[model samples]
Target chain A: MDYDPMVMDDAESLGPVVKISQADNVRVKFELSNADLSFANSLRRVMLAEIPTIAIDLVEIEENSSVLADEFIAHRLGLIPLNAEGAESLLYSRDCDCDNYCEHCSVKLVLHAKCTGGENMSISARDLVPAGDRMHQTLGMPVIRDEDGLGPLILKLRPGQEIKLECIAKKGIAKEHAKWAPSAAIGFEYDPHNKLHHIDYWYEQDPKTEWPPSEYVDWEEPPAEGEPFDYDAVPNRFYYNVETSGPLGPDGIVTEGIKVIQQKLAGLIHELTEGEGGDNYDGPRSPEYGGGGDGFGYSTSYGGNGGNQSAWGGAGGTTPFGQTPYGGGGNTWS
Target chain B: MNAPDRFELFLLQDGEKKIVETVVNGMSNCSDFTIKKEDHTIGNLLSERLKQAPNVMMAGYKVAHPNVPELFIRVQTDGTVTPREALVNALKQLVAAYGQLGREFQKELALRQYADQGENGDGSGAQGGTY
Candidate 1:
């Protein structure tokens, strides 16, 4: 077998590879309300239209499956029951007119009874049986169950006739609001291909002015005659201003205030390359700093070299705040 | 010959000196004895008479003899009444005082079981008793 050395070096140059083996991240938030269609109806629509089965296959799902799967699991475990009466009430709404309960609406099943009699009993659409032959237990099955363990019993029912059950539907809107009106805007931004890249979430907040009036206006004049004028202004002039205050109505008053704010920009750039004297330039040549240019090179007649040797020497020579230095002069520069 | 209203007999063993086995049966030939509702009181009276004979051990027996009410009597080693004897005597005295109350008690128990069944009124078989 031929081993390629270049391949190994290439892999090493790429640095430590940290690949995401499993990217099954999901987040879901549910807002419940009763003014709109019942929560049971919204959930039913999600189950029937979006995802058919309550038990979703995590391996086969895409990014958005979390919303459906979360609601399914929550409903299966009886976590979010109908609460039209109160927060803790688990009754489904009885107003839905659908022959077979759909996502739109259904009745709430509060009470459950299990008989040890020979005859079978008919349960309402609100009733639920956790496990049965007619139940949508597995994935890819029909969401709505027509018979739903409701047929007549063939054999004699004896003691210990077990029936596992829960509520049939919930009552609330998809977005929780007492008035049943849904707000139009909600969104999030992320790189699906690479999750670590960036993520931004956006939601509506109380509207207000984004940018307030400037507290100061800066004014600048061109440099004067002699002494090598510093063309760049050290500090700019600022103008201060304020907006007026007024009363909106008989009981409401609005006030606007403005003030000058000082801002500072300071940073240090370290050169990685070793050098002796500022002339031995070994650092990143940024185009913005006039180091690399595609056009003709223009040299300053007065300056000794095109590089910033003089300014670098002056700044690097002195140790700030009486800090100790390791061997002064050219050796320290190296 | 008139039938004896009550019978009394002391079973004994013949020896050089006669040994009284036990006063197996003891009854007064009259119906004058008032029935006591308390079983323990009846058991105390039976124990007292049985302990009179010396070297005699009163063996326990169930009194189902005809013309006499059934009684369960126990003879203790030291003339002390056992709880079982007291209970049986109490039950016997209750039956004697209230003649047909035993049949009525059974009927009431059956009716209770029927009511506990809720809507199911089928009384075809013996209703399972709850302790």
Candidate 2:
């Protein structure tokens, strides 16, 4: 069967449906489908392993739009402009040993600076911690700096505009190995002009081949053949068709679409079976009631009408015991 | 080659709804409306139908409840629908139009069995596949 790579890629690349615009602040509006919700819930659990504190920072808020940060990301590395005053040691504790916040696990960067003037400012852990030392154990030190002595960082805020940063330290291994790694990955790309839609189809490639292949490719699978088709199985093939409106809300995901499809498919099965002519035919059975007589009538008895006694027996003015049926013989004495 | 023993018609979505009127009114082709025949099983027939009409641009097929052994003809439109209304209409139409086909088909099968018995001169002929 010839499968369209585009369709395959789209189906496999399902994830949190996020919409981000450069014109807006560094905020992403995530619309999660049923499948995406599972991904989100799993990602949330994984993130909670290391970073336990999470909060959403809304910037340049619109009337009906709000931006949400990944809970795991926020919990591990505090969002910039927010600080953990004394929560720095939470990163070094083994009891709190998550992939993100152990001694060799995390890095905390506190950036306090007034932006000279610009529409946006971007900062990341790499800017504060040295690339090699990001996961290395180290005492406190400034990782990056700007001319204003605010350490290694970038600020585009207007004059007198200040932002505070509180970062919790942890290991980078989890962030590195997370299924949904936090990076500038092009989740999906569609160009109306080119009519080309490229989706990032993530899978564990064969460790036997190469880390990064020479030529560009859209798919990956694990090393062993045993794991070859594990992720790309049948039930996983269906994509949730989220409605744009309803009680689910514009950003809400609907799971009932798949159920609806399954039902239709079942109905088709019925049609096919019945349509196949005599395949399902079975011979008729004898009627429940015997061959038609006066359906309710009883069989006749032997004697003629005058000689025939009723089935109950003869009834006279007086009963067999000498008491009349209703009032014995209108007895005035009684 | 035989027409279906019984067939059902369902208006899965009423095209009269204002929201679906525009697309349904413009549909000039009923060629996609189709019927297929296969051995009766719980899900096989419907699965094949879905594969045949994966992306129904204008309308969708209607189906009776999963357990009901009846045909369903649904008129689909590229919009949302209530399954209840669709099912009621389908049942009504099936009774009115295709009910006789089911009875006649049953009779035909019976007659074929009787004829087989006469030819074989044995009771086992009733179990033959000639029908």
DockQ of 1: 0.00
Native-contact fraction for each model?
Answer: 0.00, 0.00
- Residue range A1-334, candidate 2, lDDT tens digits: 3324465236334422321111001111222221222223322322222211111121211121112233433443333222111122223233243643433424445434444555545444334432334432333333222345454233334444554544444322112223112211112212211112122435577432434441213212223443333343321111211222111111111111111122233233233233334222121111011111312121111111221111111231111111121112222111
Chain A TM-score values for every predicted structure, listed in order: 0.16, 0.21
Model 2 stretches with alpha carbons more than 4 Å out: A1-102, A116-156, A171-334, B1-131
What fraction of the native alpha-carbon contacts across the interface, defined at 8 angstroms, is recovered by model 1?
0.00
Kindly report the docking quality category of candidate 1: incorrect
Cα error, residue A234 of model 1, in Å, equals 35
RMSD of each: 50.3, 33.2
TM-score for each of the candidates: 0.13, 0.18
Model number with the top lDDT: 2
Candidate 2 second chain TM: 0.31
Count of clashing residue pairs in every prediction: 13, 25
